[model samples]
Target chain A: MAVSDRSASHLGEAVGLSDEQLIEMYRLVALTRALDERMWVLNRAGRIPFVISGQGHEGAQVAITWPLRKQHDWVAPFYRSIATCLTFGMSPRDILTAQYATANDPSSGGRQMPGHYGSREHNLVSVSSPVATQLLHAIGIALAAKVRGTDQVAMTFMGEGSSNQGDVHEGLNFAAIHKLPFVFVVENNGYAISVPSAKELAVEDVASRAGGYGMPGLVVDGSDVLECYRVATEAVDRARSGGGPTLIEAKVTRLTAHSSDDQQTKYRSEEELASEKARDPLPRFRAQLVDAGILTDHVEQRLGADIKAVVDDATQYAESQPDPDPSTAMRWVYAEEWPSEAPPPWGFGTAGGHAEEH
Target chain B: MPAKTFIEAIREGMADEMRHDGSIIVLGEDVGKKGGVFLATDGLWAEFGDDRVIDTPLTESQIIGTSIGAAINGLRPVAEIQFADFIHPAFNQLVSEAARLRYRSNNGYSCPMVVRAPYGGGVHGALYHSQSVEAFFTHVPGLKVVIPSTPYDAKGLLRSSIRDDDPVLFFEHKKMYRSVRGEVPDGEYAVPLGRAAVTRAGTQLTVIGYGLMAHYALEAAERVADDGISAEVIDLRTLRPLDKESVLDSVRKTGKCLVVYEDNRFGGYGAEVAAIVAEEAFDYLDGPVTRMAGPDVPGVLQPRPRGLVHDQPGEDRRRDPD
Candidate 1:
């Protein structure tokens, strides 16, 4: 994971991204990190019950979404896809609303647990707690796009651990057979909770298994924002052109323990911990920008202050929002008034009295 | 109006809807070219072609999981699980994903899809094929469970389920696919959900059942009628949001109850029916509520299902309604 300190800004230039766009990319990565840090603080203060973080995954998450069409393509993100959601047009206010679980939280109106990112407005499918269940959903989106003959591509993510799930196999196989317009990303952040990748997957790389499904499997340096973006653009183009699905395994580092609940010391030794911390992508991207002369001391200071203010305001706004109405607890289980002509949604109105009708 | 078999009515319902709305798609194992294992989806592939009528790989989870995603994107999907027995593999997808989609999204999203599976036993198809699985899904609140006993009801209910903007589990009894026939209107009709159909009238006892058991209850009701005892039969078309008032009303008038099902007796669907009778209509004086269901075994054995239909306690003497 050695990031070249030399002028690595040329990476984005090769992909025709401007210096301003590259700076914005670093800003989003920093924003996701800052928002993640705020959630951890809220969880520890007993203000929020739980937290699922995207601290170390911001690089790949942000860059992969940069290549897709906003609001047109679909995203079926995993629980730790904060940067992806934000990069896909979800604001910090929206994310914080879900964390505080207010009635206005667009994800589920306080119904779903926080970090399970989804928004119909952004074409993000609702997430299921069960691992790998969203993979088929992403494929289904791609199937609909293909059926309608639309040039829309769908992207979905999974952890290295859930990659072993049956739905992954079924989804990848189906997408390949149909040559679906899809990009299946495995954010290989080294562990599935307490289980490391070695135990979860027998193979070294998750992308290697893609060959079995007759698709190209590419392993990228997830911390390299420009490199990740380049690979995603290629996949998205191939999907739109009907070249079929691609598996991109981005090897990321889990900067924190799995979640707030997990203890890092229980599983990893001090030496292994130091190794993961050294590969933190946020600082690498920041230094990469500085070396390329795109980021100056004054500009970096202003950016830092701006990000902090946004997070603080979003936090205050969400905390002030009211909890959902208690009376609405039973609402939305079934559509109370779905259009139906058949006897108009009956309720055994006649009951025993109906015996005389015949 | 023309008389149609149960299987024919189901196909016509899907076909009729597909013609009007271009968003509906049907996908499952062997459903396309093979026309479904029981010919329930026969002639649909030719009409809709490959894009609409898709034959998927042998993956049950994807069949349902894919439908859930498709439904969210505005393409109403009707996914078929070949048999109710094979549905266990996709249990997480249906219950965790499809059923909870709308609720979890707080109505921001709706999974307008139908999971059609053939359930129930009586066809000499032993263990694997014969199972009554309505009780499992009926417990799920967000889902609507519809089981039609007649051809007319099947066509009508199928139309309603497809149009309804929520996840529905439409379990058609495999035994009635060909054996049962009824007059289906030439055009469109829908049987409203969450209502009970009283197939026969009586006062001696209330016989509550659904699917194939409801048909069997009618025959059993006629048998007791010869002895000057009337047995009212209630066919619960929709099981989840049960037609409770109908069940209670029949039990209150008859003063006795017999809850029947082909599934296991211990904690089966009939147990809930009997519980409803004992809870709501308790004031009506009569003998104890009865349940005639299959034993709590793995599946149906030969002679077990047929004998279960006629197997009733000696109760020709009418109960007192006080």
Candidate 2:
């Protein structure tokens, strides 16, 4: 059987997921795309500062995120993972609130810049402007889990350009040497800002470098949701089962500019951009659902309408939310209590006495 | 109590902490098997096994970064950087991640780990191996900087650092690893983080210092004592949360103060101490606060530079009855 046929059958066999879960994943992907598009519009309207669109890579993100045990398995995601955050249970309102630097945003309480979302409850690390830094953090988390004898694994996401950074090499080497449970997913979307991957990396396949680190490497079609899910599931399972780390290279296409500040037309030719647009992941995944008799044209149309409504409501709610208080900017610089000088829980000690002196 | 070298006290502190808390682990280059290049972690691998006493690859960034994650995930990790100068590769991890994690996470997470490096000159290790980089970390807010002058303080303060719920940069003087010995308690004990100890009391001048420089300051104080000038010596065990009260108290009583440090004279920790005195106790000063520091440009790159050695600045030199 073909790989798509196998994936379709596997999706049908997976237990505990009702039609609602599948529909929710699809709806989340749609909402993320719409929100990203709206942010681009807002950027033009001077209502938002910046945006990094997650247009084409939504299918693979939604697929992998649907089965994740959020907040349990740590996520060290790259900058282009807005959809992954949403599918993993962050509300659209929260993402929008954070984008607008509102107080209601749980990701950072408006402390961080847009696209640098992190939630303690979600176990999603704060994304930084520096690429590939999260890879080392993921490796560190995985090592901690291994040391603590926890079965949980850390999953790190990155773009193709990040694979060239020294942090990535060190992260993978450390994880592989210690046999730590972790998965590194590289979203290869053909361009890093303006420079093509071919110019940036000597190796055509980023996953092939996994062999040097003594780990299994796999490449899959990122546009196919089911295919991406299957590959990611296998890698995650291998890690959870004590088989060590896996490097997954997801072949994706960038359907938009790198970010609001970027203009892809300046670097990519018109023909190249047109070809990538034609292979957009959303429609391809919907067609696969239709081929499996699980979804029809009417269902897709209804899903699109439902997601658009949700996105509209969330955007309005986010825009209406209050901005963060200026005085609270330095509130979290240190924990409320110093480690050595934490007050007694039951009020046992003298209020201002020097305990260390006695 | 037993007399112990600074290196041995550090090893004992780690062993004691590891024995007490299962969550505490050690990792560094040659820390295990080799027992560390300075033997500060000697016998730890044999005692705690390979799992707890880990020997990491020569990647300083990974060593420091992973320790941050480990500490955040409910493990107390003590990471050694081998030498102070080599910590540059891991500077970003320390400054950005470890130092800022608690602040950025709004107390939801913390990096309660210790980064121990043998710092300062006098061992002839030269450029890469010998450096006093405490000032760099002292400038960082969330990180607590500690420099111990003796074995007792080294062990007790290290134990405190391992238990600290914040990132601490612990500097162990390489020259003092064997040369400096002191009575350290056999039982479990800890030295408070932000307190200074007065090694000696005098009436004329207060000699304020830390790490190996504290020992030098004491030697200079004793030399001055023979000339009948009473010099008070204060050892600042903790650089951050600097026992400013104790420093100010000594400076207030003596009316004259001399801050000494081995770091380069330009922008050194002595400047910070001087700034504090100038800011807090400017009216109490009888004369200008003197500072003795290593000269700029790596101090001539050779020992005993002719005419390079200088005495403490100001008019107090003539007051001695030598």
Model 1, B96-159: lDDT tens per residue? 9888988898888888999999987766667878888888888776788999999999988999
lDDT (0-100) at residue B39 of candidate 1? 84
**Cα lDDT of model 1 by residue, A1-358, tens digit:** 1122324357557987877788788899999999999999999998887898887899999999999998999999889999999999899998999888899999999988888778999988777689899999999989999998878899999899999999999889999999999999999999999988888888999999999999999999989988899999999999999999999999999988888889989998989988887678899889887887777786788789989999999999999999998877767787866232222245444333221111
Q: State, as a TM-score between 0 and 1, how close model 2 is to the true structure.
A: 0.90
DockQ of each: 0.46, 0.36
The C-alpha lDDT values of all candidates are 0.86, 0.80
- What DockQ was computed for model 2? 0.36
Which predicted model would earn the best TM-score? 1
Candidate 2 Cα outliers beyond 4 Å, as residue runs = A1-20, A338-358, B298-322
Give me the candidate number with maximum lDDT.
Answer: 1
Looking at model 1, what is the TM-score of chain A?
0.92
> For candidate 1 chain A, which ten residues in a row score worst on lDDT?
A349-358
